[model samples]
Target: MTPTKTIVQISSILEKLFEEHFEKKVEEMEALAVSGSDRRYYRISGGGSVAIGTYNANVAENNTFFYITELFRKHKVNVPEVYKINKDRRAYLQQDLGKTSLFDLVIKDGFTDKNRKLYHAAMAQLAKAQWIAGREADFKQCFASKQFDEKAIMSDLLYFKYYFADLQNIQYDRSLLISEMELLSKDLGRVQPQTLMYRDFQSRNIMVYEGKIYFIDYQGFMQGPPQYDIASLLWQARAQLPAAWKEDLLNGYISTLNELHVPRMDEIYFRRGYVQFVLVRLLQVLGAYGFRGLLQHKAHFINSIGPALKNLEIFLADHPQTPAYPELRSLLEKMSAPDMQDKYATTRGSEQSKLTIQVSSFSYKNGIPKSAGQHGGGYVFDCRGILNPGRYATYKHLTGNDEMVRQFLERETRMPDFMNHANALVAINVEDYMARGFEHLDIAFGCTGGQHRSVYAANQMAEYLRSRYNLEVTVSHLNEKKWVLPDAAKTEE
Candidate 1:
């Protein structure tokens, strides 16, 4: 693929920074995935160390991140350390916090005990950042807007209006909706700003490395009531945290804040602010997903729309008596109607009860297996890229599922990397499908012969999907005539 001009320019800066910082030549620079923002990230590995090289067209945002990182580090906030930045501030190098985002861990592990512990720790850290680090931050050095005041609040609400609701062409009294938004903004802005509100605080932006939680993408932080940050964390759409878990985390956050002794915050006051902010955050996120997914045609963001709309439904249903904004509430309810849901459905069978994921291993000679259900055409992965174990005499009789064959493939071939990439690809689709209530996915792996590489890859994928997603997964090996019991796919709802 041809590198874009901006990426090429950023790469040159990364090379220069690497040479100056480590006094060693750059060996490799690989562009990382694009994120929600315009910022581009590259992983630079050289001089026995790795760091992240980032480029963003928004120089003001870049300066805010640099300044906040420095200030927050002094205040003991857990953020990646900045190493070097370009003179123009278009690109910079920072510590690489590894690839395990909290979101990834949650999806892979499910809401496990250890994951909950990490979340509590994250909440504690968040409290400290909001209170201590927030108090010390230089407001003048803040990016774009220094505070999440009435204007900022209105911008987010209007973003939802123009980008999301308008794009959907939902019918509403526009003037009434605007008036309600004005009232809502005033109600939210009435609270005195006390802490640093991490505008985008959520699991995806939180990185877990070396058993520690670190913050990222926080340059958008602003001076606002801490409740905004709380809403951002607990009401995050994709996370889909249980209401009880949210309450526990919120209480823990409150306890941490009390320990800091910054100010006495009563539960009633805080809860009121928290609820309103949840509404605001959901609107902002829905607007973002609509613009990025529908407008820009990004698959990941498009996939996220269902979960976000679900969040909106839950919030709106819970608060039926919207005395502050009846028109706004009705508008949101109409936007999340069945017609709108169908418009954003990524695949057919998205209205089904439960999704069935069939994982099969087949030989190239025999051909790929067809999906069994109404929803046809799913993922077909070619696993022939790795070195073939079938070529070795010792492993000729062993299948990919055999313990010896599995170990051999893991050690000698690029099977682990290939499998990891495959897992990521399937995971993206599975998450979207699950959120949209899709049923049945057929994932098949093909190799030179189904007995070795393809069988092993298929078994791994089956186990991963079953454990990670708790979805109904059954493994079938076509060439070997080994098939899982038919009852294996009948999982409890």
Candidate 2:
């Protein structure tokens, strides 16, 4: 809905609500950023305080949020307190927990110690809400689905198949995949849900204000395992928590569950359920991205697909053989392959108005990544002669993207001399390519191990090209994902 129309509706609702609840009048209301859902949010100001106003044409969803909010607030869950609901239930005003989402903070400071503490605290709160408030959340008011059973799980899988998989032309036995999904659903379904499950409990859905975490977007709350929410939070596509961080947060959640005196969740069963849910959530997210990005042409959503797929790849690599569905597991591994990634690079390929200069870094040990297309080959510059940071014990785990490696390459080597000559040569070629109307160019940097010097070179080349020319640039550290040459498909939007 348009801002003007939404404000008008909010104003009307506020007027009625004031007569019933508060004496304060709203002085101002401005539209907040739109979320993935169809809800319209506004920051309403009044009586020296601010509240959030939510509007949605779908009254059922709004009602669900409202009723759930009431239930949660009654149980002291860290959710926005609802002040008023419109008679039609199309709009409501609730407490404003501030504009900062956990995602915003994470992007600003990464996974720092403070952020880790905050994540743990949020998980504790999540555990409490699920166990304490979840049981009492008026399931009758649950929107769309009341129970996350086999049917719900199948729906999520089918969403991925139709929306995401169909776009890639992946060859797989549909019946076999479905049967596997059914089996997987049964495995997770046995978890015995005891609390309310927040269907979309990611970092973005949790607001961090005044050193406290508050929840939002619980309209899809229903009876489900707490592991699903944990998967959603830790395996969030954009947040990109490292494997270590995810494990730490998982342990924190489990500890909180134990403290809450919740049922003794068998660690073995919970871990298995968590991994399955991680896969399931990845599929659900890919479907959403495919619909919002590929079909609707939203660049951000399109950009997110790469990260989401990476999260999936990480999970698959960590567990190579899916004992349950070998065929499905192989299909997922194929989907994570560079060749498969190329098939799904529609967001950039479809927008062919500008030339895309692909700058990639690889380790010679694993071989160089293929050029983006069959447009012949491109330059492959060897950085093996340069001093290797991988030789150092401290920098072993660090990649070129890390500040330490970047600084090491600049301070401890003849990188400046190499880059100067490399830049001049590439500039000459780029100028010629631009004049000739060539659409693609690839510049690869390969070292003994792609982790260090090559990564540094690729990063520098991408930066230099972006600064010197008005060309579209894509920088991919092919070896960043453990020597696996992921697609050099990250393009500047």
Candidate 3:
């Protein structure tokens, strides 16, 4: 949605929330700068008080955040206080942590002793979140996957290979690369004495509120080796912390972990796992830069590719080649070469992108949408398991595009979890098709009436793919109209 449309919808909800929950009118709502995801955030103030209001369509992620906030506050983890969640679980109000992010501090102060102390404090608190709070929290409330299992690990690796490496022609021997990825995932999964992994831990996610260190953006947390979190924080590319500082902070983290009185790890074994996580984490970030910078044409992310590549180069120099991932090391070695920077620096290969995806929604009662392309490739997702919004008289004439049906399906049904899993399965094929240079792929969603669930799924998936990859995408609701293929050999529009 455009910013204007988004504001219209969000203003309505925020107005109601302020009036009903806080018994005050919203005097002002200022848009805040956000990094990733489609979540909309506003600084809301009224009656000489201020709070942050958030609106997101991803219900599963919202629920995960709400649940984790409650758990973290109960254990003294120093997260923002969640004041209220609106009905439908998509909008909420939380305590505002006063606008000073650790990133802003580093930028303004420029890496001084005081900032270093804040870093140390943040690390110590991370230990508590992992060891004490997250140790017993209900993983069942977690969104998407509960653990960073082999499947999750491999997904990260593939994300790098396809989005970053394949775009740069770095992953040369697809079969061998797959073998190395599987082995690395197995080794990571077997690491013992696991705890919560803050999957996106970084300085930007840390808030400095009233001389205290507070962590945010952790709804992506999962059960995994604790080392991943530290590796993620210390080796973040944009921070560009000095090598000596990184080494010192790493050792400091280990000491803090030991003080927790958990089972002690052999320093050697722990360091090995840390190294693996560091390598994978760097690649994962490069993949993000590729999508946001190269495909999406964002200069801020595009400029960071140089620094991120430098970080990878530094990591490789510190840790020499290992036999466990010869292919991966070779690929990274080539990518890190100072001379090859031109390929990924200013331009993306979007002009050469070959894949086009057709997404459609249909009612099973009418018939499945038939594929007309010569490639003859596609998959159908059955969304009938989702509750039918059509069953209610208010939603009978409304389609998924209508706010009422969208709210009903998202708020009242298990559509979030169902689509989460379905997207995971479809993403595998989509990436593979892109890597293989296929010209066309088809995806369709079906439900009993196709007016609500199927249409919602199809629209959401189309939006996701368009943002994720540099591919031509089109969508049509087959149940609502006749979409005749132009020819047997083609399927455009």
Candidate 4:
């Protein structure tokens, strides 16, 4: 489904859930920013109660999250409470944990004693969670697999290989690299599943609400070494955690685990696994940055590539295991060079002359589409004022590209005035940009569902610009994947 429609439909579902569970009407619902996931989060407030409502099409993952949250609550783990779940399990509402994440805390107060205590508090909870939940939580309830075993390890390694290493065109012995990765995966997989591993245990997932640190986003949690979670947090590239904090926190986590859990974990065994998992976690993230940044061209992910590279470099210099994977080591060292680093992350301004206009249609519910230009300059027209065909059952399933939907907007609504005024504003910008020898221009149309009015306006505007101006024009509907031609014929404005 289009993100616009997804939001529109899910909003009602969530509001109904709030009224049913909270025993009050939903007064306000605001979309929350999400990162690298299709899941939608919203801040829902109603009659003296508030909650965070979530929607994801993945039913299994949703059930797993709700199930795990219940388990964590039983063990008194510092996670938000899950309240109501839809019958099909595609949506749910949970306690609102507020917006202050641990990463936000670290960034605001760097290297302070207070922040040290907060980081330590985060470590303490992770220890309790891993020790208690690992044994008690049922592995049968996990979403994908029970363990972070060889297969899971290989998936992460291959992701790094294909998306990050291979996409960067890094010259490596592919067979040898794969062989080394397989060996590493098998070796690491042999570690006994001792405790609950918070697969994405990082500062950002750790929220500081009501002056206490709480964990969030454990839908990916599974049976694995506790060392993995520690590695995930301490080595998070964006956190820029001090070396002393890394050292102190590792020692502190181990200390807490042994002090709390019976049948105390072997410190020696943990340190060894810590090294390997740290390697695995870093490479996995590089792969994520590669796909989200390099392939998808997201500004946040693209900006993160350099710091990830730096983290890998520091590991190569310091870690003793660097020599074991000679082929992997060779690739990392080559990519670490200043020249190669620029090749992956630097902004490209190579094309200087030809003007290219990118027009997009999106939903206000999903936020605006970001401009790809370096200056972040663009024109965004709110098509909400134009009548929406999505409200009608006839145009409900059909997108703005459908001939009937186009006719509905063209004949039934004020879309012509909307399109005309939009074109006039953009035409001025385009002519001025061309005269100034500028290279790119971005224009977006946003409506309620990004389906009818905005989509139709974008298509009409794209055609209008193409006919009137001698320049390249590309159009897209940001919420949906299907690319359809404008069904109606058009002439130059």
TM-score of each: 0.70, 0.68, 0.68, 0.73
**Residue pair clashes in candidate 1:** 356-440
Backbone clash pairs for candidate 4 read 134-196
lDDT of 2 by residue, 251-292 (tens): 888888888887766789778778878888998999998876
List the global CA lDDT of all models. Answer: 0.79, 0.76, 0.79, 0.80
lDDT of 4 by residue, 34-145 (tens): 6666687889997889999988888888888988888888888889988898887778998899999989887887778988898999999888888876668888888887
Worst 10 residues of 1 by lDDT: 484-493
Candidate 3, run of 10 with poorest lDDT: 482-491
Candidate 3 structure lDDT: 0.79
User: Which is superior by TM-score, 3 or 4?
Assistant: 4
- For 378-473, candidate 1 gives per-residue lDDT tens digits of 889898898887776556656776665665576557887787778778878887887887877899999888888988888888766654455677
Query: In model 3, what are the clashing residue pairs, if there are any?
Result: none
